[model samples]
Target chain A: MTSLVLAALLYATPAPQANVFTLETHWRAEDGSDRAFSTLKGRPFVLAFIYTSCPGTCPLTTAKLKRLDAALKAQKTPLPMVVVSLDPEHDTPQAVHHYRERYALEHAEHWSVFVGAEAALRTLTQLLDFKYAQNPESKQIMHDNTVYLISRGGEVLTALSSLDDSSAPLLEQAAQSEGKQR
Target chain B: MVRLAALAIGVLLSSATRAEGVLLPEGRFAPLFGLDKGQRSFAVAAFRLDRRLVTEAAFAAFLRSKPEWSSASVKPALADERYLSQEGGAAYAQAPQTRVSWFAAQAYCEWRGGRLPTTLEWEYAAAADEKVRDASTDAAFVKRILTWYGKPFRREDLLGSGSLANVYGVEQLHGLVWEWTLDFNGTFMTSDNRQDGDRVNALTCGNGATGSARREDYAAFMRYALRSSLSARSTLANLGFRCAYPATEERSP
Candidate 1:
């Protein structure tokens, strides 16, 4: 399955000797930057995918991300955030920039939004094994709404859904797991 | 398309037959099982599930109408990359979508010119079978049939969707996702002193037809428990639903 390859790319780094990181696969950032997953070399990243036009779950998802962020900040363990635009053609950098600002996600360098071509998006999506579909008539997309937790070295720690309320706990667990290793 | 057109015309012609106007039987409560707290007096439709679940194609059409609400709209729940295809992504749409919160379902139904089914109506319809005369007694057989159909029976022909519709011609009630109804507060096991007027009506009809709910009178008992366990903010993969409307004279355009 494409998910296996994508999972390998996400969980396995560019080099065997390299420290592990997650969600840093070949996917692009909002500025159209495409580098190896190693781009996020030293920061713990919380990744979520979304489109700007959605009014249903996306806003709630962002709110949950913010809640997680706030929870980490309250504990003084704030990490970087990454919001990937699933609707690349429509959700541009400007739109992402606006969304981030609207959601008050502008202060952290560890935070950035990504958009890319359909092929690249598909490749990253396949690597991550995230499920989504574009409708034929309305051209709307249906997808899973889970956020993936990636380590500083680009290794996928785990995924959390709003239903599970696993965002903050998953990140804390990842940090704790990484701390024990160090 | 012709068959669909004929079905549409048939639905138009039989509007009066589906009216939920009958009064409740004695010793029962109103049909609005879950949302009895507020002033929202929801109506119930006495129908059965169509053998086939609603398909991904049918739901995609719904998504198309409400383009603003994509899976991507919510960034952190599940991976939301598939945007407009019918491959692996179709499974989530194909399975009864559970993770859908009550708010989202209501919005979807509103967009489609219908509303979510009432808890009383959903339980009544789901628990009823063709041979089971009493609504109270039909629960066991309905549960058995649903369990049987839901097992590893993988025949594509078993979907029996548009063809083998239920008594009221509504499709895919039982085996789809546990449907969202207008009643969120109604749980399957909660004890309430309130009387359901709709169940009383169903019992009266069963009596008139010489068939009665045989197993037990725990009709309202089961619905209350299920409704209480549901959280308003949760969505799941196995949770999907069909919309309902009062069988009134006003038609959907």
Candidate 2:
């Protein structure tokens, strides 16, 4: 009888709130090191999804990231920027390294590229509300172009949806967050 | 004692059979939307689909194992306030589990060692009727589905409800609850108004579908609209999901 009561109480108890880092997905960085998403906690960061082979939008996205990086660096609040591949099977470590070199992000200290299994990628995408689909026959990927600025606690602070959208607001928020940390 | 033991074994055997689900054969299908320019039909791979919607009893068992998905425990980011509104009690045990967000449904399917069916797979399985596998073109069949869509929500026991099994032995594909698909958000890219610049212009201009494959497929259009309107965490009182698995090799009899 006592055990039954205990079970009933346990059943009603609430669980912890879910955050982006709470998802148990692992990824391989361009440097060939495997790590979980939780390891990136303790600071604000920029996150976006892209495939190295995307003929359209990806180039523009990379340019936007570079601009954002420059803006942040100018402000002296340099935050790490993570670009996760939408097509994980194609974005191997070598492909990611080549991509970095092609874009001249090879020596950028604050930039990281990651690739993971499709299932893990899907889990993270779903959590972040990023939409993407891959056509099997054409090997083309259709995806959203939203870029997220996440808080140190893993909440999405801001999202920029278009390539033309200015990063002024995002820069302001990051600077504020960095100020808070100091 | 012997009779009880026999009953227990029978129960286990039946559940094992049910766990295998129904295998759908690979085929070419023209879905309502998402067709590439000049593409008529796309090939859908063979997969195993759950015969019925996930029941409240089954979801309750899932919650027991993963309490973080419970309505009280779930974060607002993962599920809305209406998540699992009709959750507990034996009254809802046999009914289709509703008020579940797509994330929660996907989690449950993953826990079951399967995944949510893609929008294409769900539409393919739902295209069936009592006799024909692809009754989507039949005017009467389309009208029947539209009628269900037009009706208001009401709680009903799914087990003996008039929703008969389709040709593939899948039940309650329609006339029950709206289901969550694996890639629900991927269907209509143009609907996302936040997009601007050359990408949006390329999609909105002549590149993507100017109109649906068959304009008469109003029911299919409604389904696509509902899917596009929903966020990943959005939950309605009549939304639920079923699992789909990769098909294994068929054994010779």
Tell me the tens digit of each residue's lDDT in model 1 across B1-253: 9989966755663343223222222122233222322323333333322233334544555565565555656322222232222234644444433445554565555554555655655655544344432344455654544353345423232233421234434445544334566544423222231243111222232231222223243433333333444443334344456555544425433
lDDT of 2 at B165: 89
Candidate 1 docking classification: incorrect
Where is model 2 more than 4 Å wrong at Cα? A1-19, A31-33, B1-20, B157-162, B189-210, B249-253
User: What value does the lDDT take at residue B167 in candidate 1?
Assistant: 46
DockQ of the two-chain complex in candidate 1:
0.02
lDDT tens digits, residue span A1-182, model 2: 12322322333323234357756779987768897887889889999889999998898899899989999999999999999999987887788888998999878978988898766787788787677877655667878788888899887887887777779889999999999999
Error of 2 at B44 (Å): 1.6
Best-fitting candidate, scored by TM-score: 2
Tens digit per residue, CA lDDT, model 1, A43-148: 6777888887777578877888788777767766677777777787778768877887888777756677777654445435544545444432243555567787
Superposition error at B160 for model 2 (Å): 5.0
TM-score of predicted chain B, candidate 2: 0.85
What's the residue-level lDDT of A62 in candidate 1? 84
Tell me the TM-score of each prediction against the true structure. Answer: 0.37, 0.85
- Candidate 1 local Cα displacement, residue B68, angstroms: 42
